[model samples]
Target: MVCVANTTGRAVRMPRPGGPGGRLLLAGHTGEDPAPEGPDGTVAIAPHSCSWWAI
Candidate 1:
């Protein structure tokens, strides 16, 4: 599992989750899952918020 936090004010998008480049799951605080990855192969994160996914 992974948790990604966007500290900046602007929203962000990233590649779909998996593989070696991800942080391991935290002990708690799995934020809500965003909408599914877009066809362009990315997930959206709201500004100054967090999201999580299984690696």
Candidate 2:
């Protein structure tokens, strides 16, 4: 899951309930390409921004 903060433009990494090595499933973004890679190979977004996702 990606959490964004609108004002700070920072991304919040939420703790996984299952502990370490948890998996986050991301769906495709319509009208846009896949998320760009980040430091941890996960997509990064600004804090409090609008969330676009799929189940």
Best by lDDT: 1
Per-residue accuracy of model 1 over 1-55 as CA lDDT, tens digit each: 6677877777678886684344334322335345556788776666667766567
In model 1, the runs with Cα more than 4 Å from the true position are 19-33
Candidate 2 local lDDT, 1-55, one digit each (tens)? 5422234545544333133443434332322223455455455444545443422
Q: Show the lowest summed lDDT stretch of 10 residues, model 2.
A: 26-35
Off by over 4 Å in 2: 1-9, 13-35
Model 2's alpha-carbon lDDT is: 0.40
Q: How high is each candidate's TM-score?
A: 0.62, 0.29
Give all candidates' CA lDDT scores. Answer: 0.61, 0.40
**Global fold similarity of model 1 (TM-score):** 0.62
